[model samples]
Structures are given as C-alpha cells and as structure tokens.
Target: METSDLAALTDRARRLGADGRRRVLGIAGAPGAGKSTLAARITEGLQGRAVLVPMDGFHLAGAELERLGRADRKGAPDTFDAAGYVALLRRLRHPEGQEPVYAPAFDRALEEPVAGSVRVPADVPLVVTEGNYLLLDEGPWAPVRGLLDEAWFLDADPGLRVSRLVERHVRFGKPRPYAERWVAGSDERNARLVERHRARADLVVRLG
Candidate 1:
C-alpha cells in the first residue's frame, strides 16, 4: 500500500465516525493479508475518535481447545467465541452509559487471550474490529456482517501471505519447519474459507 492509499483510507474512516453516533468498521481477511495493520492505521488516523477491538481476543483458550479436541486446528472458525464477539460489537454499537466497556486482547507471546486488556470508551464514535471470520456466514458468525457499518476485505499475493504467516509463526516461537507445516495446513485452510466471503465486503482493498 502507498502513502496516498492510507491517507485516503484514513480520510474515509474519519467520515464514518463524523456523525458521532458510534459506527463499527470491520476489517476481514485471510491470515497475513494485513487486516490488523490496516485497522490499527485507520484507528490511529482517527486521532482518538476510534478504538480497536480485535476478534482474536475471542479466541478459545488453549485448554478449552484441547478439551474440545480442536487444538490441532487452532485457527479454525469454531475455535473462537463468535457469539461473545458479536455481543461485544452490539454493546459497542449502542453503549448505554458513560462507563468504558472492557474488551479482551490476544497475547501473542502467551498464545491466549487476556481479559480487559482493551478499554473502549463509551463516547468513542468508531469501533474498528478485525479478524479472519468476520465475514463468515455460518452459525454464530452470520450476524457479524450486519453489525458492521462498513467492512473492508483485504487481499494480497497468496505467496506473500503464506510467507508472512510462516514468519509470524516462527517469530512467536514455532520452529521454522513446524511453522511452515502449520501455515500450509491449518492456516491455509482457514485462509481459503475466508476467501469465500470476499464478495460480501463493502470494499475490497488489495495491498501492495
């Protein structure tokens, strides 16, 4: 992405919250497609008008995943608390009081979610949430799209995406060989599933 593109996106995001009536902007994309990067940039551009509430915070605990026998496929759609995420979005959409709403954050180093790591002020006008399954239409995920005032789907070169995933895994303590295998298997599968919902986005951003 170029500087000008980010400026334009920032300007656009600014307008989404201009009315001061809380708006939820969602960023959805396959792993390594830059959803979080873009979301954080857009939020930063808003200059305190927005708060980021990532979907990764809803990820099931490692213990829960192990008990459910889904530990082997950690990034799958079912491994997250989809309903809980949706509920939080709804709360953000219509905040009832002055108290800031607390949100969970994913701790990459620990590979788990830390509760109350994010505080969303009730008065903030925009909430930017990003994740892999925001655009998914199955089960509890179906309501996610409707809750968003606008959604952007990010796209990038497949090879680059996979390479980024591998690097990220390795950075987080996975051996390079094991990272490659996980990206090729579990992560790639989730990426394909995410691709199916590209057409549902309000905008499709192709990252350079």
Candidate 2:
C-alpha cells in the first residue's frame, strides 16, 4: 500500500474518540501476513485509544476441538466459532446502554481461548480486529464485512510467509520437518481461502 494510505488509516483511527462508539477498523490477510503486527503497531501508537480484538480469540478451545475430532484442522476457517465472532462484532458495533461487551482472548501459553479475557470497555473506541476471514463473504463470516467501517488486506512475499510459519511451528516445539508439513498442509490451505477475500478489502497493504 502507498504511504498515504497508512497515514489516512491512522488518521481515521485518531479521529475516532476514545468513547468506544465509533466504527471499527478491520485488517484481513492470510496466515503469517502481519495483520496482528500491523494492528498492534497502530493500536500501540494510539496509547490506549484503540484496542485490538483479534479473531484468534474466537478459536475453539483445544478440548472442544479434540472432542469434535477437528484438532488437526486448527487453523482452518471452520475450526473457529465464526458465528460467535460475528455476534461479538455486532455487539461491539452497537454497544447497548450497558456496562460493556467482553470477548475472549486466545492464550498462546495454553493454546486455548479464555472467555472474558478481553474487555472492550464502553468508552474505548476504534476497535482494531484482524484475522484471515474478516473480508471473506461466505457462511457465518459473511456478515463480518458489513460490520466493519473499513478493512485492509495485507500482501507479503509467499516465501517470507512460509519461512515465518516454519519458525512459528518450531517455536511451538515441532520439528523442522513437521513444521514444514503443517505449513504446507494446514496454513497453506487457509492462506488460499483468505486470498479469495482480498478483493473485498478497501485497501491492499503490501508489507515491505
């Protein structure tokens, strides 16, 4: 993406008050595309004005996945509670005259989604949610796009993404061969599905 677009994106977030009533900013991309990193950077720059509500927080609990016999398909789009994620987004978009809406957060240490771990306070505006399927228009994820005020799709070199996946898996205790296999079989599939939604984004962010 051009430098002017990032400036505009940041400006848009800046214009939203810290009152949790403004529209949300969505960033969608395939696995290892730096959605989280970009989201974190933007929110961090705001210094508490923006909060990141990542889609990974909606990942099905490990135990639930095992029970459903889909633990092997962890990164698959269907593996997540897409409907629940949409519901949460709806609530965030329109916070009722109540305390606030709290969503789950995925704990990397536990490899599970912990309920009520992220509290989107009633006063914090500019929700920066990033995920692979935000721009995807199918199934439960279809409703997600309409809820977002604006969205960006991140593009990166495929080789860089593959390398990042391999290192990620290795950090999680998998051998190099197994890491490569997981990246090829699981992550790659998710990446392909995510690519189909790139056209739905408002801007294309190419990571340099």
Candidate 3:
C-alpha cells in the first residue's frame, strides 16, 4: 500500500463518484487480507464525499446464529443476512427521498450487529463497501457483484493473512489457542471461498 497507489485509488474513486447517481466501490478479500483497512483509507482520502458501508454490519446476530445452529461458523457466507444486505445495496443505488439512508454496523466488542449505525447521506456520491463475500457468485450473494460499480480483490501471502486473522481474533477477546483453532477452521474455509472468486473482480490488489 504505497502512497502513490493510495493516491491513484483515491483518484479513481473520485472519478467513479463523479456521475450523477451514487457509485459503489466494493473491496473484497479473504479474512485479514485488509479489506476494511483499504476501505477506510479510500473513505479518508475522499474526505466527505464518500461513506463506508461495511458488509460485516449485515452479519446475523449472535442470538440468531445460535438459533440457526451457525454460531460455530459465524463468518461463513451462510451466516449473513444476504437478502437484507442486497436490499440495502439496492436502496443505496436508488436512494429514495431526501433523507439519508441508514445502514447497520457491527460492534466487535459485543459481537453483534447494531441497526442503523451508519448513515449514508443522499448527497454523498461514493459508497465504499468491504467484505469477504463481495465477489462471491453463489446463491443470494450473486446479486452483490452486479450492484457494485467496481470491485477490488485484495491478495496477500497466505501465511501473513492467517497470522493477521489470528491476531484479530485474539484482539477481539478470543483466547490465543481458540483464535488459532478458529482461524484454522472457520476462517480458513471462508478464505478459500473468497479466493475462489478473485477472478470476478474488476481489479486484484496485491497487498504485500
């Protein structure tokens, strides 16, 4: 992520948002491949012209996951409200009225989705969304790719990505050993799924 590359990406985003309608730029990557970081950087670079709408915000609540027996595979594609996410994306594409549209946000500390936590003003031109499944083409997630004006897939060394995932889990309150196990199990599976769809993206970003 050099300064030059960041500047170019920001400039590209600005151009995409220049059209009359809102433009969506999606950042897709495997777990710990730095999707969120890149999305944040783009938003910051755009100043007030862009707003972030993370896909993680649409994660099924822990209680709902437990009820569906999906608590163990929390980060899996099936564990999200895919339809709801798609609906939100549609609303963002065709904003109604003059009011800002509110989107959900995920709270890492509480491990829950907070409703209406992010507001995307109608006047904002660019909406940056990052997630593991943005490029996924199966089931309900299929519509996601069509909605985005541009999609970027982040590529990183597998070992470094796993290491980052382990650290992230630990930072979020999981015991070190448990985090390692989760990374090896659930996270690894999700990572593979995300990688499988890398070719579908408009661009592949090397995040070494």
Q: Is candidate 2 or candidate 3 better by lDDT?
A: 3
lDDT of each: 0.92, 0.85, 0.92
Measured by TM-score, how close is model 3 to the native structure? 0.96
lDDT of 2 by residue, 113-159 (tens): 88998888777777889998998888888999999988888887899
Model 1, which residues run further than 4 Å from truth? Answer: 1-4
Clashes of each: 0, 3, 0
Q: Score residue 31 of candidate 3 by CA lDDT.
A: 96
Query: What does candidate 2 score in Cα RMSD to the true structure?
Result: 2.0
Listed in order, each prediction's TM-score against the native is 0.97, 0.92, 0.96
For lDDT, candidate 1 versus 2, the one ahead is: 1
For model 3, the stretches where C-alpha displacement exceeds 4 angstroms are 1-4
The best-first sequence of candidates by TM-score reads: 1, 3, 2
RMSD of each: 1.8, 2.0, 1.9
